[model samples]
Target: MIEWLLLLLPVAAASGWLAGKRSAETVNADSHSQLNSAYFAGLNHLLNEQPDKAIDTLLNALKVDSDTVEPYLALGNLFRRRGEVDRAIRVHQNLIERPYLSSSQRGQALLELGLDYMRAGMLDRAESSFLEVLKRRSHIGITLRQLLDLYQQEKNWHQAIAMAQKLHEESGEATESMIAHFYCELAEQHWAQKKAVETTRFIKQALASDWRCVRATLLQSSLAMEKGDYKRAIRCLRQVERQDPDYLPEILKPLSECYQYLEGQDKFFFWLTEASKRHPGCTSLVLARAAYLQQRGEQKEARYFLIEQLRVYPSVEALQQLLALGVPEDIEAASEPWSLIEEVASRLLKAKLNYVCGFCGFGGKYCYWQCPGCKRWGTVKPLAVGT
Candidate 1:
C-alpha cells in the first residue's frame, strides 16, 4: 500500500501541474505564477491534514500521457491487491484507450487487465485478454501459461494441450509431464462417459507424451482389465513399480485383482515376496504380506510378521491389521503397548492424507495429476511408504 502512495506522489505532482495549467488565464504571463500558487495551495492542504482534498486536487489535475501510465499500472495493481476488481479494470481500460501508448505499453495494459479478470473469476474475459496478448507474441510465454491455466480451470483439456505445447516451444520449458496430464484428463473424461475407444486413444496419447506417467499407466491397466485381458493389465500395472516406486501402493489392489482373475495366486505370492524384499517396510507391501500369510493358513505367522514389522517400523495400517487379529497380551512392559500403539495409530490414521503435494505440502485423500493447492502439474504424488 505504501508503494501505491509512492507512485501516486509522482502522478499527483503531474496532476497538480495540469490543474494549475488549466486554471491559468494568461498563458505567457501568469501560467508560471498560477502554477506556483496552486502547488503551494496543494502543499498547504497536505500540511493541514486535508488529504482527501489534496488527493482530489491532485487527481483532478491528472494528464494521461506515456510517462504517467507506468505509475497508473502500479495503482491498478494496488487496486487488484485490495480486491477492488472493478476499479482495477477501469484503470487498465482507461490506460488502453489512450492513443499515445506504445505497442509494448499497450501489451502491458492488456496483461494487467487479464490478471484483473483472472482474479475476479471472469475466466473467459481473461482468456480473451491473454489470447490478444499472444497475438503480438511479445509476452508469449506468460500469455501461453495463463491460457493453459484458464483452459484447465474450464476443463478444456484440448485447448490446454495446445497451449502447453506452445508454451514449451516458446519458452523452451519442459512440458511433457503437463502435456501427459492433459491427455490423461481427456482419457478420464471419455472413460467417465463410457466411451472406451476414445478413452483408450487418449490414454495411448498420454503414454506417448510421457511414458513415465503413472496415471496413464493406471488408466491403461483399467481399460485392459475391462477387456478381461489380465496379462496386459498386469503388464501395465507392473510397469508402475519400475516407472516410479512411489505409486506402488496404488497398484496393489489392481495387481491383486488381475492375478486373482487369472488364478495366479502362487505367482502373486512370489511377486509380493520379491516386492517386500525390494521395497522393504513399505506399508502396502507389509499389509499385503500379512493378509497373504493369513490366507495361506498361517495366522500365527501373519501375527508374528506384523509384530516384527511394528518393532522395525510402526504404522497405522499395520496397527489396524494387528487389531483385526486381536489385542496382544502384554501385562507389564515399559508401557501397556497394545492400547498405546492403537491410540497413536488412530491419531495418525485420522491426520494422514493419502496423497500429498511434493512442491507445496498440500494433502488430500485422492490423487491429482495437478496439485489442487498449488495448481502445479505432477506435484501431487502418492504418500510414500510410511508418509
Candidate 2:
C-alpha cells in the first residue's frame, strides 16, 4: 500500500497539472474545479489509509486523452508488477475503450492488458488480446513470443512450433533447439499412444531441426530397441557420444542392454574402455568398465580400475560399487562391517541428485529434456562427478 501511495504521488501531480492547465483555459472552469476537488478527495482517502478508495478517486479525476494515456499505462503496469492484476486490467481496458487513441497507443494498451490477463490466470482472454495485437501487425515480435509461451504452457506443441518458426524468421533468433524439443514432445506423445509411425516421423523432424538433439537420438534408440533391432539401437546410442559426451551416462545402461541382447559384452567393454579414456569425468562410464571387468572374472583388475578412477572422480556411487566389490562371493563369508558401510554408501548415493539444470540449478534424481525450473530445452544434463 505504501508503495502504491508513493507511485500515485507523481500521477496525482500530473493530474493536478492537467487540471490547472484546463483551469487556465477560459472554458470549462466549473469542470476544472470539480476535477481539482476529486484529486484532493483522492489524497484525503490516501491520508485516511483507504488505498482502494484513493485509487478509485484518483482514476476518476483523470480523463483519457493524449496527455493522460501514458500516465494511465504506467499506472496499470505498476499495478501488474504489484500483483494487482484486476486493477491493471481495468485501467488498460479503459484506455482501450477510448476512441481517440492512436494505433500504436491502442496496441500498447492491448499488450499490457494481455499481460494483465495472463498474470490474473485468465489465459483465454490473454490469448485473444495477444492474437488481436498480432492481427493488427502491431508489436509483432512480442506478440509472437507471448503466443509461443502461451502455447507451450497449454502443451500445444504444434502451435508452439509454428510460432517459434515465425519468431525465428522475424528476428533471426536461434530457435532450432527449442523447435527440436517441441518435436520431441510430440514424438513422446505419439510413442505413449503406440503410434510408431507418428513417433518416428516426429523424431525425424526433431533431428532435422537440430542434429545434436540427444533426446531425439535417445528416442530413436528406444524405438529401435522396441522393434528388436539391437544393432540399430547400438548405432543410435553411439551417436549420442559424439553429439554430447556429457550424456554418455544416459546411454551406458541402454548400451549394456543392447549388448546383452547381442551377447556382445566384449564389444561393450571395448566401447566402455574408449569412452572412459576419452571422457574420464563421467563416473558411470568408469563404473561400467569396472563392472565388466568383474563380470569377466577379473576381480583384482576391476578393483584397481575402480580405485584409479575414484582417485580422480570422488563419486558416492563409485564408492558404493567399490565397497560391494570388496564383499566375499559367499554370503556366509561377507564381512558385517563392510556390508554396513556399503549399505550406508548406497543410501547416500540414492540421496544424491544425478542430473542438474545448467540454466537454473534445478537438481533431480531423473534426467529431464526440458528443465523444470528454467523450462529451457536440453539444458539439464547428467551432473559431473565430484561436484
Candidate 3:
C-alpha cells in the first residue's frame, strides 16, 4: 500500500503542476478542486490497501495528457510485474487508445501490451502486437528478440533463423552458433522426410554458419553411411573428434560400424589407440581398446590395460571394464568385491546425468539443444562419464 502511494506521488504532483499552470491561463478553480479531491480519494483508497479500487479510482481520475503518460506507463509496468496481466493490459490498452499520446508513448504502450499478452498466454495477440511494433521500426532489437523467442517456441526454425540474422546484422552480436542449430533443425526435418539432397544442403549450410558444429558433422556422417559411403562416413565421423571431443562418445558406435563395413579392423585398432593416447582417461576410447584387445584373444593384455587405466581414472565405467576383463579363476575369488563394485557403479551411473546445461546448471539424462531452465542454445553439453 505504501509503495503504491509512493508511486502515485509523482502522478499527483504532475496533475497539480499541470492544473496550476492551466488555472493561471483559464482560472478553472472548480475543475481543479474536483481533480484534487479525486486524487486524494484515490490516494486514500491505496493507503487503505484497497488496491483494485485504488487502481480504478486512479484510472478514472487520471487524464491521458502528455504529462500523465509516463506515470500511466509506470503503473502498467508495476501491474505487469505484480503478475496482474489483465490490469496491465487494460491500462496499456487505454493508454494506446488515447489520441493525445506521443509516438514513443504509443510504441511503449504497444510493447507493454504485447508483454501482457505474452504473460496471459495469448501468443497470437502478443505476436500481432510485437509485429505492429516491428512495422513501426521502433524498439526493433527488443521486438526482434521477442519474435525470435516466439518462433523458437513454435518450432518455426526458418523464421527463427531469419530473426536471428536480423538481430545479428542490427546488433553485431555473433548468432552464428544459434543460426547453425536452426539450420541443423531444418536438416533433421529434411533427413526425416528422406530428402537426401536437401538434407545435405542444409547440413552444409549449418557447417558454413558454424564450422565446428558437431551435430552437423554427425548428421553428415549418418547421411554418408546411409549412402554406403563407408570411407566418407569415417571421414565425417573423424571430424567430430577435432570439432568437439565432448561428443566423441556419440561417434564411437557409428565409427565402429564404418570400420566394420570397410573391413578395416587393424585401422580401427590403430585409430582407437591413437585416440586413447590423445584423449587420455576417455572411457569410451578405453572401452573400445579393451574390446579390441579381447577380440584379438589378448585377455591378459586387456586386463592389464583396464587395471592401469582404472588406477588413474577411478570411474565406475572403468570398474565395469575391469570386471569384464577378469579371469574365470579371479571371478570366484573376487565375486563379493565385483558384486559391490557393480552395485556402486550402477548407482553412480544412474545418478550421473548425461547432459548438463552450461547456462543454468540444469542436468538431464537426455540432451536438450535449448535449456529448459535458461532457454539458451548449445549450452547443454554431454557430461564426461569417466573423465
Best by lDDT: 2
Q: Rank the candidates by TM-score, best first.
A: 2, 3, 1
lDDT of 1: 0.81
N/CA/C clash count, model 3? 0
lDDT, model 2, position 382:
89
Q: Model 1, range 229-254, lDDT digits (tens) per residue? A: 99999999999989888888999898
TM-score of each: 0.85, 0.90, 0.87
lDDT of all predictions: 0.81, 0.87, 0.84
Weakest lDDT window of 10 consecutive positions for candidate 3: 325-334
Give the clash total for candidate 2. Answer: 0
| Per-model root-mean-square deviation over C-alphas | 4.5, 3.1, 3.2
Clashing pairs in 1: none
lDDT of 3 by residue, 293-340 (tens): 999999888888888988897667767766766545646765787678
Candidate 3 wrongly placed segments (more than 4 Å): 1-28, 40-56, 327-335, 385-387
Best by TM-score: 2
Superior candidate under TM-score, 1 versus 2? 2
